[model samples]
Target: MTGISYRRPSSYSRLIGVGGARGDRIVPNGDLAEALERDDEWIRRRTGIITRRHASREVLVQHLAEQAARAALDASGVPAGEMDVIIVSTVTWMKMTPGLAPLLGARVGASPSAAAYDVNAGCAGFCYAIAQADAMIRSGLARHALVVGAEKLVDFTDPTERTISFILGDGAGAVVLGPSDTPGVGPTVWGSDGRKGDAIRTTHDWLEYKYADDFRDVPWPTAEQDGPTIFRWATSVAPHFAAQAIEAAGLTPADIDVFIPHQANLRIVETMAHTLGLREDAVIARDVIDTGNTSGASVPLAMERLLREGTVHGGQTALLFGFGAGLCYASQVVELPDAVGGDGEYHADAPTAMSESEEIGAGE
Candidate 1:
């Protein structure tokens, strides 16, 4: 109560200058949608979601991931072949080996040595990935890093786990980080807690039996949720961590221009906004109602929504909150530039040299 020490974030960090996003169509009719039909007033009063996006199984995680990555690559005017490293920040991946990072690099024809791999930090993963890549640039480890937050939750979602099904969606958002002379463009504040990992976690396993010629097996996928505990924990935990981050930068919550909490639940977002003394529209929130919780992909997905809809203009301070799974959470204020390379000029439809689906894998 007196003083909470949020481990200080690395100082050798720079702002991620360019941001990009792309997602699929989202429709309602899961759990909460029906609950809302039960009583519109009740649903609105309890949670703030009117609708959420649901990705089709046909749209693989790799497709959306590549689309989002290409958008950032196009918007930044930095060729995919020029990236220093491409970090895929996700808990859900296209495959177990090569981490999908290499697969992305290979498909795009980035330098053969273009470092690529996957890293997970629950829903807060994107922030963690950005912080890591920023440090690389600020530390002279690399000239540029592509951080992508992508997830095809459809791959792991257990429809039976209706508690989260109504609140989750699939999509990807990407940003390119490089050096900048701007003041607030780089410095960051971040932290994590592994103790409450189970507060919001997903688990999977494989099963088999020995039967020689007459062998048989039944492998199953199981996703669980302790709904109430997660909701209450998020409301309390997220704000505390967010405050800790803003405080670390010698700034108060008032200094932030936008608050982007992982679109977990409408109530959770509203509670955090109220606690932080922020206006409803001050923070960029959407896509979740249509996307559901794309796990760690949520924040960037929301950022992509703002970047495209024109809600988030250049040079705005954004306070992003990512909490879930791992019972883990972290926060950072990104001093995002209004345009690529601080160019005040804005482009509605940035162009990519080659479309992912069109260019990759010759035959669809």
Candidate 2:
């Protein structure tokens, strides 16, 4: 917090690179049929999720974030020591302190003086972090910032829960934002309806469990949501944000090149697309079909997928939005960043700017 200057700079902030890392274990719809009492077709029809990935016990949330940060850093050609800020967005961090940002900054070899911290805006976290990074760069607080969104929702998932078992997944995604000569990130449009907070949240209260005479009587907390509530809210409100983002960027819906909303559900994606009246040529991300709802990680993960597949290219304008638990939401229009291989896949021999020894404890 030492960099206190808040005056607006003459230049703008642009995303230079982006990368994503998914869990190793793939869980298909068949894997959840018994637990949810639902078959593959049913799951696909309802949530449009055919499969998802669950992080193994040995893979910590920090590991996924580090991998993503490395990819983004490598793609950007930005040295770790040059990082002025590192912001990690997540709600699934296991530790109560030393938040994921610092741990990720260490793993990614970020500067010791870099401002590092975490944000927990639920599934909307990535959008929130992006907005913050944009402000920091434009306001002269930082020149280069690494923004990451990672989640290990599997740690809190209840296997037998019908609404959540088939929806949640694990993954991390990252982007490098730096000072640019022109505006690449537009003004953000965000708001939260805390009145609807209970529509999605943990099943048990941590504070209540801690003070209980018999903790065993309290069930371990797991995620739960009012499905109908979210579906209705998202479909109705997301299009408004999308339109606002496009306008804020001085563009029209037809001018938008890509649409990357949070990959929460395929149905939601399609519904929002219809509402936006997106151009036939505009690419809409459907990464959720494979990655599932990774909460805070979904937006960036989806963005990486679109870029990797060459569906969207660097310099193209993309409309990004995120909404989830706490009824929080954020939307922005940003120019796409360069991807590894001209796509988003990382090359094995690409210099990551970090020595091999420094990459230790990545998955440990």
Candidate 3:
């Protein structure tokens, strides 16, 4: 048999646009004070979060993802029909079947033939999805791709759980990537430590609830984490990998114009920046102060905030890093895009919404 042929790869992939969407409800530390039995100051001292957004019970993961994706598409001035691929990174979609990507693509009016799927790398998901999209584009498998990170952590959080309840939030962020004449997206440096997998995970597995001796008495699965463990791992690993990512791009920390780490905590962000020896002029993202830890959506959301506020401008070089859950982490360097959208506004008229009781299957 003749050998299979392949399409020529593109020279590079670059971000064309960025967007974000936050939940409708703003939840302050004071709101969670009674449950966590801690004062607002204590919460702020620990996580650097004064407030966070929580989607109304009526809102679903797909709604946040679709809204963010549409904003990115609109900002890029690229109709959804031109998209060749769509990747959604989320852990709170609830349903296992009928992956959210296809639905999001359809909602955004992407071409029927576009390849779409979901990614579950926890907090590092968005970066992972970006790496994947960059690869696909470089290999000529896609001409334009949409990468989104969305989460509704409220659905998986227990208000009384002091370790995580005060830290979680809901939101989504997205970016559009297309071919570039020069290197715009840099090499990705990523890895995971599964030995610490239990450091951040749901309290119960689906099988445990399904096979429970008393179904009604079974606790619904909610997220929990070993705060100290995650904090320690993230702080130590971030600096190393961030440097590797920068080096992989043939640059040094001084060359970076901005720093956007996972908005996990303010202390972690500061610690990593210092240890990495970044220039004093590098603008560091502190979106966590108001957005809390948005899991996979953190990086893009923070990036969007910086761009929208004029703190960082287009063509600036940024170092992006994300670490959490799976103990997984990913880092890369990229040239910032000019188009930015989504101003933390919640549109009630958004098309996608689902009730809390809905039980949809994966890939349905």
- Which candidate ranks first by TM-score, i.e. highest? 3
Which parts of model 2 are misplaced by more than 4 Å? Answer: 1-10, 341-364
> Residue 160 error for model 3, in Å?
0.6
**TM-score per candidate:** 0.80, 0.92, 0.95
Instruction: Select the stronger candidate by TM-score from 1 and 2.
Output: 2
Stretches > 4 Å off in candidate 3: 1-3, 350-364
Q: Residue-wise lDDT of candidate 2 within 2-48, one digit each (tens)? A: 87655566378999988888887889999989988878999999999
Give, for candidate 3, the lowest lDDT window spanning 10 residues.
355-364
The Cα local distance difference test for each model comes to 0.65, 0.86, 0.90
Q: For residues 1-364, what per-residue lDDT tens digits would candidate 3 score against the true structure? A: 9998988889899999999998889999999999888999999899889999888876677888888888888888889999999999999887778888988888889889999999999999999999999999999999899999999999899999988878988999999999998998999999999999999999987888778898878788898899999888877866898899999999999999999999998988999999999999999999999888999999999998999889999899999998888889999999999999767555878665344334243234
Residue 234 lDDT, candidate 1, scale 0-100: 79
Off by over 4 Å in 1: 1-23, 30-46, 184-189, 207-219, 279-281, 340-364
Q: Candidate 1 residues 1-364, lDDT tens each?
A: 6886553333354444344333455454445446334443544455566655554545556666666776666676777778889888787674557587777776556788688888787688888887778777666677777888887666666554545654566677777776665544434455666676665655544423243343344334444567788887777766887887777666777778778788887778877788877654575575565556777778877776666667777678788778777766768777764443312111224333335543323344
Decreasing lDDT order of the candidates: 3, 2, 1
